[model samples]
Target: MRPGDIKILLVDDEASILQFLELGLRNEGYQVMTASDGLTAVNLVREFHHHIAILDVMMPGMDGFEVCSMIKKMAHTSVIMLTARDEIDDRVKGLKLGADDYVVKPFSFQELLARIEARLRNQFPHLLNEVTIGPFRINDQRKEILFNDSMLSLSNTEYDLLRYLVINHGIVLSKSKILDEVWGYDFGGQENVVEVYVSTLRDKLEDDDHVLIRTIRGAGYRIDLP
Candidate 1:
């Protein structure tokens, strides 16, 4: 999707930072929405399906971590936490709660823009919009997956994971690599989440005697083309 086609939510208690990000992103042709606090951000998220959310971690009432968790559950939006706190624990905590990336405050607009672009590129790779592997057919543009022409209901995370696997079909992806690529720069290094999602996909995509995703022992997982 083009940058102009992407919708982004900018949340920060500080009006200056919020306006800065909104203006910068809009200059790049992106559709931008601004919120002064986490609670407002959450409400906006529920009202609109934002493609990316840049949240301030220090918001009053609902913090960024809390908002990130809520937004993750609501939509398949990529989240980046922007905060002045440089503590490692806070970064890890945000990632664990499903923030796709974290940025320290006092950051340059160029750097922030680069990070936003990187996140979008990673989440929505520029490749074939549609792909087919084994019995599954995937429409990356629409975020839809089908097994033998039968549609499979998937959450945002499930669709992202499945899309990544299908894009790299026949290649073994290590847990760490998958986490970095699919979950963004930080995921609290929760490798088990990958396992859980993979299990869920197999149960939905696999038949009695057939499995689309396979474990490679100590390595990670692969979705081999059948």
Candidate 2:
């Protein structure tokens, strides 16, 4: 996915800091949402599906620790605590509450961006790189897949399904989740279409032994990538 496709949440009680970050990140092509308080930030997390959050610790009502906890309980969003205090106690508190990183106040904008990139690299590495697994190579930019040194002619649906599985390799994705993601939530197609498409992809990849994609019987499908 491109930079604009990654949604980032910015929360700071200071209006100027929030505006500065929103402007700078937007200039860098990020989709950003800002909140001045913790409750609004939590509500946005529930709706925006943000990939990462930069939260200030000194908020009025909820504070950053509470917001960080709420966000962790609900979403898989990576959190970086932004605060003026550099005390080890505060850092430890944030880390114990599931905050992924810590950024001190008075930090440069470039440093913040670097921290964001570092977090993305650790948390969602698949989003920023082409995927290669054994005999398969996936170029997301070109939306092309090469298998065994041969390009596979894939329909759009097939490409989407394959790429989704490849990026999320080894994760057991349920039929309902796959259906909503690949076929879209509004798709009128039958759920069995996922199974059919899986078979088609396996055949195209020449996986007659079904070793590439494994079915968990009662659970779902997981792609094993080398």
RMSD to truth, every model: 10.8, 8.5
Candidate 1 lDDT: 0.83
* Alpha-carbon shift of residue 193 in model 1 (angstroms): 25
Residue-level lDDT of model 1, residues 1-226, one tens digit each, is: 4676788999999988888788889998899999998888888987777888999998779998999999999998899899898999999999999998888978998988877765775565543355555677877788899888999999999998987887677789999998998899856767899989988888887633435688899999887775
Q: lDDT of model 1 at residue 91?
A: 91
Question: What Cα-based lDDT does every candidate model obtain?
Answer: 0.83, 0.88
Q: Once superposed on the true structure, which residue ranges of model 2 sit more than 4 Å away at CA?
A: 130-226
Model 1: how far residue 23 lies from native, Å: 0.8
Q: Candidate 2 lDDT, tens digit per residue, 45-139?
A: 87899999999999999999999999999998899999998999999999999999999989999999878876775577557755555677777
Runs of candidate 1 exceeding 4 Å displacement = 126-226
